[model samples]
Target chain A: MTRRASMAASLVGFGVSVAAIFLLPSVLELFTLINATIYVSMAILALSLALIWGYGGILCFGQAAFFGLGGYTYAVAAINFGDSTWAVVLAMVVPALFAALLGYFMFWGRIGDVYLGVITLTMTLIFFKLFNATAGDAYKIGKAALGGFNGIPSTPPLNLPWDVGSPLAPEDIWYIAASLLVLLYFGSRWLLRTSFGRVVVSIRENERRSELLGYDVRRYKLGIFTIGGAMAGISGILFANCVFVSPTMFSLFYSAQVIIWVTVGGIGTLLGPIIGAIALQMIVAKLGTLEVIDPNVVLGSILLLFVLLVPKGLLPLMQSGFDRLRRPKAPVPVEPAIRPTATPAARRPEPVSAPVGSAPATNTLGGS
Target chain B: MDLAVVVLLQVIAAVASLVLISIGLAVIFGMMRVINLAHGEFIMLGAYAVIYATRWGVNLWVAMLVVAPIVVGLIGVVVERTVIRFLYGRMIDTMLATWGLSLLLIGAATMIFGNVTAGVSAPLGGVTIGEYQTSLYELVIVAIVTAVVLALMAVLRFTQAGLIARATMQNPAMAASLGIDTSKVYAVTFGAGAALSGLAGALISPLSGVVPTMGVAYVAKAFITVISGGAAIITGTLSASTLLGSLNTLATFVATPVIGEVTLLFAAIVLLRILPQGITGKFFRRAL
Candidate 1:
């Protein structure tokens, strides 16, 4: 398929999916819509990580820190302003600002990928511990008490843009969440097609080479990392509206789960992580209903299976299978032209080291 | 003077714990360049080994010293064969794989033991210092840590296997050309790292108890110490542990544990910013 043809097809598919989701409330109960809102919010979180880690070659283990910060900021601001509208804006700005600051230090300081993961993770833990420790009355912010480990409960639900007193119903909230997911998904897809996206992807492919070509590697990385944080902040706002914001949002478990969602969805593609998040969340919800078996065991085993057997993830696997089916019947002359262009769209980022199955020639103990 | 002695003891204990948890990571990550995110889970496994052994009527000392390391070391060997061997030199993939491994280990442990915290009490009685009383086990930890570091140093400096392992890590192709089985060296080194982690877990089990998710707490500290320590495995691990550990303990004494932890993390970030290659990466460049 040509680039234009493939793009049009994806756009049509995206539109159908969004429309289906917006109309889902008619088919499902109110309780299910509430649950769906949470799942949509999680999908948004997964998509944010996918953009940064999958496309940018930067792995952020502490994405949840930004997420929790957004939720808490929203909760506190909502309580103070007695309106959810401005609180939502504060939620996005707070996390984006934090990410900008953190990313500047991380990228400008020349922190390696391995150390980046460690640093972000430690930062998340610090946030978790800091919040968990703030249980006293002195921990109050304005009218809202920073309830420490209990988290800020009874957070004001997202209100309409025009009115402070009117809050959306659970069904309406589900539509909003679903619409946000669709918009963000297509927005990221469109961004990836832009020149900046190409530059970031090129940087991910080879940082030193990008630098030699006059690209500011650090600035680009900071930009993407901050954008990822903003997306995560948006997810947090959606989540806070659905379930009360808590310290657990900043926990390592959530951090690890976000990675799993991106990995299992197939990195590098915008759609994979969103699908991975929703699918895994559904499986988890179903598993929770079962009392006999421990869900962690099932989830952990699935993660292991994905990493070991399907390292490229479900999307890549499906893409490759589709490619294989289509390749034989196609003419040989068009194959080479289509192959190169099609790959970047569905391509898994090459492993940072040498290709798998080959012995790496570089000294392992030297600089990372 | 007594209060000073107590603080000194706490500092030593803190440093020892950091060193103990990180030595294994230093070997696996520093030497092999394979980021083992499951290093903490290996420690947790060791603690569980001790807990299970003691329940089966084994002595506490025996459970901690002998059984825990052996079980976890064996598990390490199995992990290397099945998962890690394929991922040699691919740091990020190894990280993801090991993280999955960590989650699996945590889940499996939870299934077997449930979510409740289980523990073995410290066997030694408390010791008084001036107006303060502290666990005698702290002293035991200090002694064990010293012995372990000394033993590691001796083995790495004086043994033929150590030479082969170092050669394999430095240049696997050259080592292979010289007829050394680099894969075997990697397996042994990984197993040894796991054993050390197990030993650390066993030693601390009495103090903090054993839990499936306990690995999360130790993994970050271990990574921070190893990374800050830099490439020279032993010297790097020791120096970084002492620096961070002492700072952490002093901070804890000054304020609260939460503040202490935050201080430690902030210190690590600052240190990384100043010395991105880590402390030993800059200072002890030639030290082993």
Candidate 2:
């Protein structure tokens, strides 16, 4: 608990993470390295979900809308912007701006959970249909060509002018991806530790409480939503470089997959989602290679099992098991509130007005 | 006059299909808090069931009647008891869980059905109405949709069981306090929703080709219809679908079909911006 000891532990953990990133390919079997890189990208995407759902308390069903936008933006920019670092930056910024504008309307309007999810889903569908529609020879945006349904092909790989070797290879790309992942992971963690991040979490737990505490909750929510969208855009930039960006990348199914990664890992935990993405993708990919039986059947069964048995996700399940093993003989306190009772109308619904940390739930745009 | 007749028939056909899909979706949403993204999968499965059953020498109508509801209903029960039961109160998780179920169903169907488009012959053949050639199957679809709508309205309006379902949906704890078994209500609602989905699938299997990925296409439209319809039963869904479908149909006629679809999306977005409660919700409020 000493500052020196804490710093040492932190340094050690950082070293271990970096080592795992570099050495995971050699230690694991069957494209684990490539898989890890992709999962890292997915984790970036999942982080956006965490920021929105876990912290902001907004369940956006269409994070893939931003992801797809990021991907298309990156692909289009990389193709047009002459293989420079500026192209990648532009790709990230364009989508970030787009997300900020969308989030402004949604958050400012005071959309509730179900309505928020619907709006986001609809936005993604609109993007999908639009992308599909504009995919023609005549359609052109800057130097980038919109290929419609058949997406832009032959997108240039990452171009690091100062790198000593060929940056186009998977290994080089992996290094770049690994570096960016570290930066983003730490950057996000640091962001959450800041006042803004605290406000975001407060917003998630109770908007009304936060509002009453005199914080501008709407502005904070919009701010975080936009940041998450930007982070997703960053992931999209990486994704476009890793694989060919297509309109299908923006599909609801793809958005659903991002949620699955976050859920399977554990929402609210920083590392849980990345781990979930890596593990689930490996399982799906392996199952897909199996003969006779369908991978989708396996996926469905697993999803059902997870949702039923391990609702908080694999991380929480593992954590609980670890805790139990660490302290086995302690008496478990029974929660009287959760006890099952037949025809149970005894308990009253607790009026949770808002999370207690900061601000009240005030939709400022209502006045507008 | 000929062009007008063609447009009318097209509108009728589109309305029949739209009504079938929208009503089922509306009912499911009304009963269960679950916005079943996989509802389309049930429809797809029913279509496949009819396709396979017809191939096995069963009469098309009999196969459609027997296979659709049962197949989708059984899947619904399994889904409700297993995955969806846990996902209550968590909208994002519900969406994700249903989506996973959808992917599995679509993928499994692809593996089994080989991703080929297949169709079933309608029970009634083509009919000539005056100078126009109209399919009797289309007329049957329209009639069936109408009958189903009327039956649904009656059940929701008059039946004690329907009242319980509505009560449970509006307030689960209150309904339970009033002696309704909320768990049973939830299960029944889920089953009924699945059955409607299957029914829609069976009805439209002949009109649209049956394929694994077909459900994905319908998923957005169904959700859009429900949202546009204002989360109510019968009237909202029917009116929204008709309005949107007509817009879509007319847009296609006036411009390139792609532009029409885009225009519809644009209109919906604009409408969503203007009236978040949706068209049906606004109208119902004013009418009352």
The regions of model 1 sitting more than 4 angstroms off are A330-368
Query: Model 1 over residues A1-368: C-alpha lDDT tens digits?
Result: 44465657677887898778867899898888888899999999998898888778788999999999999999999999988888888899999999999999989999867778878988898899999999989999999999999998888888888488798888888888898988888788767667787777777766888999999999998888888999999999999988998899999888988999888887666777888999999998897897666667777777778777776677766755665577666432211111111122223343344433221211110000
Q: Pick the candidate with the highest lDDT.
A: 1
Worst 10 residues of 2 chain A by lDDT: A335-344
For candidate 2, the docking band is: acceptable
> Candidate 1 falls in which docking quality class?
acceptable
Native interface contacts retained, candidate 1: 0.47
Candidate with top TM-score is: 1
Q: Which stretches of candidate 2 lie over 4 Å from their true place?
A: A1-10, A24-35, A161-167, A329-368, B82-92, B111-114, B122-136, B171-174, B286-288
True contacts kept of each: 0.47, 0.37
TM-score of each: 0.94, 0.87
User: Who wins the DockQ comparison?
Assistant: 1
lDDT per residue, candidate 2, A275-355, as tens digits? 777678878787777756777777766765665566557665565565457557854322111111101111112233433
C-alpha lDDT of candidate 2 relative to the true structure: 0.72
Per-residue error (Å), model 1, residue B268:
0.6
Q: What are the chain A TM-scores for all the models, listed individually?
A: 0.89, 0.84
